[model samples]
Target: MSKYLDCYDYAAIHAQAEHVVKHRKKLRRDVVQKYLDWFDTHCATSKLRFQQAQEVIPGGIEHNLANNHPFPISIDRAEGAYLYDEDGNRYYDLLMAGGPTILGNNYFGKECAQFIIDKAPLTGLYSEYERKLAELVCQYYPSVEMFRMLGSGTEADMIGVRLARAFTKKKEIIRIRGGYHGWSDQFIYNASEAPEDAACLNGIPVECFQSTHCVEPNDIEALEQQFIENEKFGGTAAFVMEAIGQDSGAVPLTREYHAAARELCKKYGALLIFDEVVTAFRLGMGGAQAEFGSKPDLTIFGKIIGGGYPCAGGVGGRREIMEMLAAGINKNRDKKVRVGGTLSANPLTAYAGCLTIEELAKTNAHETLAKASDYFMKEIAGLTEKYDVPALVFNHQSILHIDVAGSQHIPTIYKKDDPEFARQSKEASQCVMEFAMALAAEGTIISGGGKTYLSCATAPLVDEILGSYERVFKGFE
Candidate 1:
């Protein structure tokens, strides 16, 4: 059993979520503008850089998560728990490089550089470090009998679904609504803020989502129904979800739900796929499956798997399912799921991943990270109470959610043509963005205004982190 199992209080999390849903709140428009002005005045360098970037990069950002209200702050350097912007302004980095740097930024830079110096990153051939990384993963995650590296979380998820279909000879995949399993065409269905299935298919074809189905998080009944429905064409290939819940516990899951879902997959003959991109290492060394005591048939990993480096994604599972990815030239080709990436599990990333897992084990860093998250949750609760702000703050270990606007709690199923629901979602999203801008101006970085991924390095900055939240809460209407 993992020591971090007691790190979460699901009862408290659900109660707080209900309370916040009943009393949604956000900062006043004037207060939001006040912070936006801070960016315009204080972030001259970043503004200039963003303007220059817009000329080359569409929307002046590479990752969708980097888009801020005013403009994305240009990060010049990142040390432990803090990001130094090009304007010389320092901010507490609660984003944690979008859920990768668990030991914190640049924690083992010298070691990674030394490994790269020795191994030169890639050789278009297998590296010993890849096997070492796979061994470490299999050692910690009991569900992962064998591991296969890939290019990104999207690629990993793509292959996971494909492998499930090949292994089970099934077609459809069932995903929890609003759970991001990467931007792949099949998984992108039902991802919009609205409940309707057609809202997000701007570029992707409608037929791509035909084999994909959605269920509200923790709705075991709905999940089982989807599996039954998929039997018309083919049995559900996989039930994929973020184990904690969609958007890193924006809609949290219950332990009962986890246990039931696991059983349903067994009954329905569907592979259970946990997208542990954010929760794998940050939750604990054994990942959320171990923490919850519910084992998944296949697990999707990203972020910390490469130790905060690029090309960080993979799929691991029972040896039989994983062996379908074996490298061969048209040998049992019909039964194989083909996947390839020149840079996947290259020397540097694989070596760094091994080092990260070793360091995490050596120092027992996840427990420290959980403590820091617990502290953040407490401070946030205090601030919200003191200001009479109805906000939900919860965590699954170090993965934190601060839903001041309560956008995430909005119902997953709603009328397709309901203008009122659309308006509410738009307002909530905009307000969330503005709220994040306020926090940024106050020198704290959070993801999409509500989620904050913390690390072991966050322990020392707990007070400072809360100070930023307090300032933002104080500006509430």
Candidate 2:
């Protein structure tokens, strides 16, 4: 439906995925050992700090991305395209603070810090900046005539799902298999590539997944079948997915697929929800929905929404559906979604979010990011070829996905209960983690060794990063 996505070659991406799965590759054991040795030698202070942190902090990390092998590198400071570790080693940042720093780290921190100094962080009440942030979101996201801010992406997803159920008066929620909405109980049903496998349900009860259904990405027939199957029960509430596939486009989806999904939702009387947590402003000011030319009934926002600040999540959509989250007394309390957060829409995050969006529009950051990513992706293709590796690299604008070992697609390749599945999955995961370590050792950082969230500020580092990838590739087995 939209030519904006012509830049992405889905056929090439799928071929890459196939190649990696059929012939999985990883860093050589000696090469991986060398990378580990480098971490032990160069990141002495970071190792010490993480060891100290283990006494109190679980896994010596607050974020999952920080859980790296040989202990995570403790960052002392971040500026532009680099992360300065406590050990004084500076690495080029391609993670972009886990996909929030679109304009780069601390781009608008000064203004936001000044705002915090003037107005404080929280007031436990209304703030004009909250209205301003919501207005900014609504202005860009055409599907969102109204918006409601939340504390994090998880919270936003929780409420978005609730709003869908409330609006449709249904009990079932359908999500793409392997798609992650959040850590919320209902939404985390199928968090892996395995269809209907609630593998992450440690503390979550089995009944929490009753109303959730999983469908593989790009399977329009499977999706429509699930909706039809739901009709025998309570009918479908919503069909939610990461527009570009799971793990932020680790498996890419096409515009034709998205358009079909949109129509199916309408035909089945279910709302189409786009989980744009990582893609929101990164895809464009208007988001993935705008680029795809398909309007979702509700859109979830996070990460860049708060401009890399806290309280960075929201759900926005058509007025009638969003109005279900309205505050104040209501006689129809049972009909409305009950949502609340003490720190949501606080002064600090709100002002920063507003400034970030304004800057995104003013600076034309997307154009810069697009050009930079084009260069980066081109180089990655060359590196993969030169290394004689089965890896694949592709991008949805600035959100670049480099499938080193095809770990993200493992569940799709192997049955979850297969005897070889566990072994293959573990090996693939290790390969990915090791690859990420190799990149970090080469003065580059990415998300779990697979995903890279580039920013306008990181555009200048394209050549440097290409070199970094080549160095890492040289160490591959």
Candidate 3:
């Protein structure tokens, strides 16, 4: 219920998280082994495919999402709400292609395929679809007065940070710890990896990371302190964060806190940048910013915006800030940042983005998907309680977080140096890996580390997915 918490009871959620982590060790060993044994028998074909792919693909997989524990399952094809693996097994698609495909696997597959074939995938120029897509984004999202497309969310982040620094003429960027804002160098500071390693910052040089300030979420005082500290150096360009907290709300933040942060940014002459790559079409057409009523000066988008197509991300915001990327508007447009890509706004992705956003808006998909997500969370939470499962089932909009390792989602700032955090992170990491493998064998595709996405088509499959989860949970003893 912290999802519905008015002011966000962080202590309550953190306490539950700690209890669950400690409890995970008590789960039956035989129950887990039983599922692993089942995987060996049922996933023979997938295992063979992985063995063959390792010769070509670096880790036998291309993307991090496919990084399963033993080996990832190779999907053959997908329909509305299900994925069919090469082993001739079908699994409920809880991942939703990592939070796109709101209308399902192939919302208008035939039409889109035919259109791309008739025209061209890349004509080396613009399409009406590009303008149409931008129009739809600007119309649905109040914050997006002007928009520009990029290849992926990572590219959008790189571009967005540059735009922010350029527009504000400030060098420092303050982001919340554990906020995953794509793999851009600036944002990689506190994203993806464990929070404790934020200081070392491997690969990225010190000068690069020194331009950004990282702070823990849910504490306005810490943010204010960071703001004060930045005054000693250059001013902050932006205070960028996910609409929800890190890991797609693994650590949720209160509405009041976000508003306060926005005010702090205003006080320090920094742009308030909300990375809406995951939340854009899911929380609302205008994204989480709209749902929470806390507007941002700039917004970054990915995944759902491209409608499960390639080149699926962008940045959009107020006219003044967005127009900074305008093409050839000024010979001295070097004053404005230049954002360009080979396939920046190609027709295929533009059409997919245009059609996807239009359908989501017209169908009010968020309302339906939210109900489905909440139902899954509520029922699964009860299922965990009844079966004594050591997992926490909760969600922010359609993105669910299942704490298989049971560690605190956002650990206290002080705990970074504690051995307690390391132990819990290791335990939860193992549990999550084994749990994902178990779910795959039980006929569900989930993100490896306790997170998965919901979509408009999730309503009908909830019971089947829940039933599978229940069966698997009981087996764990």
Q: What are the per-residue Cα lDDT tens digits for candidate 3 across 13-45?
A: 676666666666433678777777876888888
Clashing pairs in 3: 405-428
TM-score of every candidate relative to the true structure: 0.94, 0.95, 0.94
The count of residue-pair clashes in candidate 2 stands at 0
In order of listing, the candidates' clash counts read 0, 0, 1
Show pairs that collide, candidate 1.
none
Tell how far residue 306 is off in model 1, in angstroms: 0.4
Q: Report the lDDT of model 3 for residue 279.
A: 82
lDDT tens string, model 2, 1-477?
A: 001123246666666565687777778788888888999999999999998999998778888778777678999999888899988999989988789899888888677778878777787889898899998898898899999989999998899888898899998989888888888888777776333544656787888888899888777899899999999887999999997788888777888789899889989999999999998988998888888898999999886788998777999999999988858568988767798898888888888888889989999999998998877887787778777777767778898877778777766667878977788778888888888888899998886746688887789878877888888888776
| Model 2 lDDT at residue 467 | 86
Tell me the whole-model lDDT of each prediction, alpha carbons only: 0.82, 0.83, 0.78
- Estimate the TM-score for candidate 3: 0.94
lDDT of 3 at 370: 80
* Per-residue lDDT value at 447 in model 2: 67
Error of 2 at 272 (Å): 0.8
* CA shift of 195, model 2, Å: 7.6
